[model samples]
Target: MSAVDVYLADQRAAIPGPSWTRRDLLREAGDHLEDATDAYTAAGYTPTEAEALALRDFGSVDDIAPGFRDTVAIGAARRTAVLLVLVMLPQAFLWDGGIELGASAHSAAPDSGLFHVLDIIIGYVGTAGAIGALVALAVTAIGQRWLRIGRRTARLTAAWSLATAMIVPIIGFTMLTLTGGLTVLLALSALAFMAAPFALVALSAQRTLAAC
Candidate 1:
C-alpha cells in the first residue's frame, strides 16, 4: 500500500465508533488526501513525494484521534439520549394499563401496604427518570448549539440513562407482581414494553460510555 493508505489504516485503527461513522470519517480523510496528492503531482512532484507531503499536512493519528473520538462520544451520547426519551416518555401509559389490569383482576383483594409503597416509589422514580432523560436529550440536541459539552458530560448522561433504565423497570415489575395479578400475558407485556425498551436504552448508554 501507498504511504497515504498506510496512514489511513493507522487512523482507522486508532478511532473507535460505529461502522457508519468510521466509514464516513475515513472516506472524507481519503478524499482530502487524494486531492492533496493530485495537487502536488500537478506541481511536478513524484507520486511518492506527493504522498509524503500530503500525509505530513494531514497530521498523525495521535494528533487527530482524540478529536475524532470526542466526536464519536458526542454522537453516541446524542443517540443514547434520544433512545432514553423515546423509551421513557410512553411508559406512563404502560404503567397505567398495568395498574388498571391488576386492580380489576383483584377487585376483591385488600390493598397490600407494600404495594402502595411500591406504587409511590415507582411513580416518583419513573417521573424523575423521564424528566432526566428529556433534559439530557435537550442538552445534547439543542443546547449543544450554544454550549460546549465534553466527553465527561456525555459519560455522565450515559451513567444516568443506565441507572434509570435499571431502576424503573425493576420497580414496575415488582409493583405489578405485588398486585397478585401478574398473569402470563401481563408478564409478557411487561417484558416486551418495559424490559425490552429499557434493555435497548441500557445498551445504547453502554456504547456512549465506551465511546466517551
Candidate 2:
C-alpha cells in the first residue's frame, strides 16, 4: 500500500470505540487526503510525491489520533446515555405492574411490612435513576453541542448508568423473591424483559467508561 494508506491503517489500529464512529472518522480523513493528493498532483508533482505531500499535510496518526479517539469516545458516551434513557423511561410502568402483583401477594401473606418497604424504596430509587439518566442524556446531547462537556461528563454518566443498571435488578429480584411468587418462568421472563435491556445499558456504559 501507499504511504497514505499505511498512515490510515495505522490510525485505524490506534483508535478504539464504536465501529460506526471509527468508520466515519476514517472515511472523512480519507476523503480529505484524496483531495489533498489531487491538489498536489495538479501542481505537477509526481504521483508518489503527491502522496507524500498529502500524507505530510494530513499530519501523523499520533498527532491526530487523540482528537479522533475523543470524538469516538464521546459518540460512545452519547449512545450509552440514549440507551439508559430508553431503558429507564418505561421502568415506571414495569414497576407499577410489579407493585400490583406484590400488593396482591402481600395482602394474602401473614406479614407484609418488608414488601411495603421494598416497594417504596423501588419507587424512589427508580425515579431518581430515571431523572439521572435524563440528565446524562441532556449532557451528552444538548450540553455537548452548546457547552464544554467532554470525557469527564461522559465518565460520570457512564458510572451513573452502570450503577443504576446494577442496583435496579438487585432490588427487583429481591422484591420478586420476597413476594414468594417467583417461579422459573417468571424469573426467565423478568430476565428477558427487564434484566436484558439493563445488561445492554451496563455493557454500553462500561464501554463508554473505557473509551473515555
Candidate 3:
C-alpha cells in the first residue's frame, strides 16, 4: 500500500470517532500528505521518495492520534460517570438499612466498641470514596484544560473510587453481623443481593476506562 494510505489507516485505528468525523480527519490528513508529497517531488525527489518524505513530515500515527484519542476518552469518561451515578442512586436508599443494622449490632453487647468503630470507618471510607469518584469524574468531564490530569489517571481514580464506595458498606455490615446481632441479618441479605450489581458496574467502568 502507499505511504499515505498506510498512515491514514493507522490514524483511523488509533483514534475512533463518528464516521463523518473520521472521514473529515482522513481527508485533511490526505490533503497534507499530498501537499507534502508535491513539495518533496518539486524538490527533485523520486515519487517513492516523495511519498516517504511526506509521511515522515506528517508525523507518526502514534503521535498524531493521541490528542484525538484523549478527546474521545474524555467523552467516554463523561458518559460512564453518568451511568455509574445512575446505577449507584438506588443504593442510597439502602444506606439507612446499613445504619440501622450497625446500630442494632452495637446494642447487642455491653462492649460494642468495635462495632461503633467499624460503623465510623464505613461512613468515612464510603464518604471519601464517593467524593473521590465524583471529583475524578468531574475532572474528566471538564477536560484537561480545566483539571490538568491525564485521562487515564482520571479514569483509574474514578473507577477505583466507585469500587471502594460500593464494596465498603457491605463489608462493614457483614462484619457487624458477626457481633451477634440478628437484626443485621436482613441487612446482610440485602447487601449480598446488591453485590452483583456493584461488581458489574465496577468491572464495566474499569474496562471502559482501560480501553480509553
Q: lDDT of each structure? A: 0.82, 0.82, 0.64
Candidate 1 vs. true structure, TM-score: 0.88
TM-score of each: 0.88, 0.87, 0.56
lDDT of 1 by residue, 1-212 (tens): 99988988888888776656667888999999999999999999999999999988988889988887777777788888899889987787655755554454452233888878877888888888888888888887787899888687789889999999999888887877766778887787788889999999999989888777
Scanning candidate 3 in windows of ten residues, the lowest lDDT window is: 101-110
User: Considering only N, C-alpha and C atoms within 3 Å, which residue pairs clash in candidate 2?
Assistant: none
Clashing pairs in 1: none
- Where in model 1 is the C-alpha error above 4 Å? 97-110
Task: Mark the 10 consecutive residues where model 1 has the least summed lDDT.
Answer: 101-110
Work out how many backbone clashes candidate 1 has. Answer: 0
TM-score of 3: 0.56
lDDT per residue, candidate 2, 1-212, as tens digits? 98888988999998887678889999999999999999999999998999999999889988999888888887888888889889888777654655444354442332578877877887787888888888887877777678877677778888988998988888888878876777676677678767999999999998888777
